[model samples]
Target: MKYKTFQTIILISSIFLSIGGCVTSKPSAENNTNYTISPPVSNNKMVHVNGTKIVDGNGNHIKLKAVLLEGWLMWNGTLWGAGLTSETKITQRLEKMAGKEQTELFRTAIYDHFITEKDIEMIAEIGLNTVRVPFNHTILEDKNPLEDYSARGWKYLDNLMTWCERYNIYVVLDFHSLPGGQGAFVSDPEFINVWHSEEHQQRTVDIWKAIANRYKDRQIVAGYDLINEPDAPTGKNLVDLQKRIISEIRKVDKLHMIILEGGNFSSDFSMYDSPLDGNQVYGFHTYNFFTDETDVKNLEKLSELAKKQNVPLWNGEFGAHKLSWIEDQLELYENPKFPINGWTFWPWKRVSENSNRYRNLAKIIPGDDWKEVAKGISDLFGPSNKITPEFTKKAMDSFIEAVKAENIVYDTEVKDLLKKY
Candidate 1:
């Protein structure tokens, strides 16, 4: 079906339950409710080698450059769109918009109410293969009273496993927010101590044990992202703790990949010494366009370690501000000289935009982030893993051609988008 126009209307739909507290969701779907969507699928291939990391039946790597799943469908509190809420009405919209079941990978939000069995089916329809699940520690513990972090979440998670088997996609479980939030300085009081605390470290291990034992039999879960971005009270201790956590999960579920991010949330590729049972994947995040090229060079260094280890490395999450940068990244990936295992971009959107906040995350939706990076990057998926050297060169050349063809620095859509933001 085609949507000629969309309207936003306010409706009251109560999702309250005694087992898990609920509330009335804010504006979620469009007022124009003339659409058809399939529910989530439950026939995933969920393959694994010896019940652990991804591998071919013959012990080869499974190469797939999956797209990064963003919360374009709903907000859950991070930067950008998260500022719009202040713990009040945080998860309502998400819960309301979830469970389309056509999507493959849903990069979860700080509050992932968007999770529903029907949504898993929608993922299968979209031809997606996995969900790169992001979570805050509180999702496992519920530090806030009004929030939910109950063990009951596992009941639903098992339902997700059932879907993965029916639909076949790997799960990259990322710990986005730690007890003290993963960064250097978190204004949120819950993260007052940082990862250096013995309390926080212990809590992390315990949580993983619960996570691992819960789905040890399901091989679709590729690995556990040790911690999100640990810039806090920075030191070698965070690295050491990661090795220990790997040990913990290894003991519980030895058949899966264990991914660890770089130092600065991007990739600093520090040296750490904790070994897994030879089925681990080293991973990192990249937002270098927001940083200097020098930082990117540092992150690129991880490629060497990944090669030496014969382990695959993926940009767990990354997206650029412009279309040009998307192609540039693909070039880096195609560099047989500096091959990266796979890459996933930031998001995919469902909503048009958030009205109140001019600089909201949904900004990337109708206009900015998702649109600019989408086709540009997807186009770079050349026939063989080889990124045609001429590809990015051609992308740059296209802009130059546009400038000469129109003799204009500002395109119409760019101007309108900038004005809107």
Candidate 2:
């Protein structure tokens, strides 16, 4: 758990030196009895951290310039122009108003079009080498007590990996929403507070274990981001859960990197004394809403910790600011003094809403009718006011069409900015 000297940490560099730079682990019978594990095809590069730098199978350094496929698997209310309501409430309301079957159909359509092979092609065209995919727990596991694992959720990831591999891009599978909930915001739909429930913690471990079991042999996967922005009661609690998750994952898969984010919105790392896993990266998220000066200071402190611990640092999530400010952060990430590995922009697409402060960052326009649907589900809509079922149906259909890569208009400026870096 603790390292006495940095030299001891350097031993991690030898952990992966195989053809794909991975220690291959066979699929476990108990977890993956029917699943077949295939050897990675020829010349597929696996990524691992070498002391302080992230490198590919050939020992070449790799900076993970990525974008978060935000609105794809996880339905963030804000991304839908529905204000800051929790995904739980939004889905429940839609089900109630639109009927369960209809709502399910709408969800299926959204999932199908939100991010397809076309999106992956666009990401590759943008010249970015990586994508950080944030998926809610509901995508993979049953809600609350957590019982059954969904095949649909697994298919989403399976599809993504296939597309990313074809496009020659790596993926960081991010568990954005935990079992019970991480409390507040659109990320946690149930809002039950995952830190308080032992069942939820175990469920979290099981989810990661299943993920590791499923993707153990897939070299296209860059890493597993354990949890996204854990808002635990204390840093120790956060670190404890992360350690457990990492331990469980290593049991099934040890080849891929394990990315750990700090507590309190990934800003606090005082609890982490040393790296828990050999092929690991410390991820942090920042919008730099305060002053620009603090951005440098924050990265300086994180960069120093990475060096002290002898691991790579990553800007996991960012970019809800002006393009110029985001470009500045990208510059800082590349600075020799900081030496942070790379960054994944907060979100790739969202509805352009007037009420949203980060509206400028939205690349695709969801459609004019999206605002009406957003208001229908939002708290501001009173009982007296009603959105007819016909209107809802029409809007939902429009939404499905709008999210398709070919259907929606893209903010070329944002693409141009990302391509520049």
Predicted structure with the largest TM-score when compared to the true one = 2
Q: Candidate 2's residue-wise lDDT over 151-256, tens digit each?
A: 7888889999999999999999998888756533433443345566666677888999999999999988988999887666567677777777877887788678
- The per-residue C-alpha lDDT of model 1 at residue 229 equals 53
Candidate 1: tens digits of C-alpha lDDT, residues 1-421:
0000211110010111111111221221122133221221223233332221245434555643444344322223332232323121233222222211211112232123334444455445444456666655655675434435455355445665676677776666766655644443222244333343556566777788888888776766766767765553334656556656766776767665666666655466665443233555566666643332433465457766765655566667655345445545656765655545555545422222332221111222222332222223323231222323344233323322221212212223422332221
Candidate 2, residue 355: the lDDT equals 22
In TM-score terms, candidate 1 sits at: 0.59
Q: Return the top candidate by lDDT.
A: 2
The C-alpha RMSD in Å for every predicted model, in order, reads 18.5, 10.9
- Residue 270 CA displacement from its true place in model 1, Å: 2.4
Give the Cα lDDT of each candidate: 0.45, 0.73
Evaluated at residue 248, the lDDT of candidate 1 is: 71
